[model samples]
Target: MSTEVKLSQSTAIRLEQARTKGMSDADILKAIQANDVAAFDAVSEEDYRYDEFLSYAADHGENLEVAVQDGYRITFNTRGGLGIYLEKAFGVVAEKDFAVGEGIITGLKLKPEQAEVLAERLASNWVITESKDVPEGKVLTLKLRALV
Candidate 1:
């Protein structure tokens, strides 16, 4: 017995294009099976780009300690939160109001020195809100938001 799988119009078009580029059907099927191209295609453009960025960061030894929700938020560890902190702080200060930026700096608990470094980095990004201290051993909360 044999099973037949129908390809969607987009996928059919892609297969045709691959064939035109001299990719044999067996080669294309092998590539698709090996790489799970369907899964890759299902990922949103933004998520795909961010994953690529993370890979690049890892390659450069800047391994970002972070958690990502694909197309939503990216929560960075205290050490990696400086960039977002600065971006948010500058936005709030420039608006002349105390509005927290889209990203935040929160974690289990940061050392005073770690917090100071984050504050300084954020300050260099421009004006920002003051850093807050977290209680020791407090569980960090993750609030996922939709990407703008």
Candidate 2:
């Protein structure tokens, strides 16, 4: 089966930024077109484990999951880390008390640039306030609007 991932408009822009940062346009396009992880990693900065993290699998019987922390939406996968989420209350955030990964974070307002920076560091589909899914074999958790 093909394990390719399509790029969202934001992701495409992110790739474009990396390509313009000195990488070869041809190579960038190839990675985007094929959804190549290694290709993306080549252009990404060091310390970006999101690719591996994205493919990671949490130990069995774990609550590990990926979530948009404050957002009601969550997913169950094998990744481990923090995911950003939107709370019911506007501009409100809450850090969930997770077991494996760093907890969640809420009420922290970031500018577009800040979010972009975080996106690079996280290498996630989107910024997650805190997540441990995929790595933990569970769905995300955004129970409340208060810090864990």
Candidate 3:
């Protein structure tokens, strides 16, 4: 008897890349099981952006998850952080609370770049606002209203 397993697009691509680099199937399977594979090894640009979070997880040996509540609450594990250039740039604390308001200006406080990246990735209808008088000189707040 034989058993077959299906792999996600990203995983398949990674497996192929690893094979091309002379990694045996057994070695690849062991590495994957141990969570010790390099994220960007032999991956093309197209697959890399397919799901940015997967690359982050593979890189840090940690998982990143996001939760949305009522289309307003946007929270994610910032373990590996977002974006390739700014992994550890911001000092964000875990479980940070951001008030949910209906166009009343209340949400997560993030750097302008960080806010935009996260907002765009999470939803297309997020409203981002920047306030400079809030001690940080220039901070962008992320607010989600609806997914319409």
Candidate 4:
């Protein structure tokens, strides 16, 4: 018996690029068959955007705090520390967070750069706003409003 699998346009482009780089057709096919290939590898990393969270929020209406013209608003509070906050907010803790002091992080708004980092975990179009400043030894509250 024989089987045929269709390649996506992006994957086809990747296959061609690999061939141009001296990879054999048999090798490329073997890699694809083994599921060891990544389509994004052929593209620029800077161009990738994560928007799964937006889709989920849109479909389920879970965190509909306020509806903006293009998206909705959601909020997150952090009391323990950046590590704890990241784990709770995005479900992943980065090594850099561990290196930082475990002291409580309060009123820390998500910067544009930080948003990019968070997007890698929970892809969403959002803007972070600090509703109130964190007093000494207080928790941080952040308002994240979605954007189209």
Q: Pick the candidate with the highest lDDT.
A: 3
**Over the stretch 1-148, how does candidate 3's per-residue lDDT look in tens digits?**
0222222223333333444546555655454455554533543345343244355445643322211111122233221222221222233432352443343234345656655444434323344554443554344454444522
lDDT of 1: 0.32
Clashing pairs in model 3? none
Ranking of candidates on TM-score, top first: 3, 2, 1, 4
Give the per-residue lDDT of model 4 (tens digit) for 1-148. Answer: 0222222222223333454445555654454444443522442134222123233333554321222112222233222333443544433344432222222223444444444444332212223222333332222232323311
The best candidate in terms of TM-score: 3
lDDT of 1 by residue, 15-115 (tens): 33444445555654454445444433323244122223333434543312211101111122232243323223222122232223344323323455534
- Could you give candidate 2's per-residue lDDT for residues 9-60 as a string of tens digits? 2333334345445556566445434546676554465533226322332222
How far off is model 3, as Cα RMSD? 14.4
State model 3's lDDT.
0.38
lDDT of 4 at 7: 24
**How high is the lDDT of residue 68 in model 2?**
14
Off by over 4 Å in 1: 36-148
Computed on alpha carbons, the lDDT of every model, listed in order, comes to 0.32, 0.34, 0.38, 0.33
* Top-down lDDT ranking: 3, 2, 4, 1
Candidate 3 wrongly placed segments (more than 4 Å): 1-91, 94-97, 100-107, 129-133, 137-141
The residue-level lDDT of candidate 2 at 32 comes to 38
TM-score of each: 0.23, 0.25, 0.28, 0.22
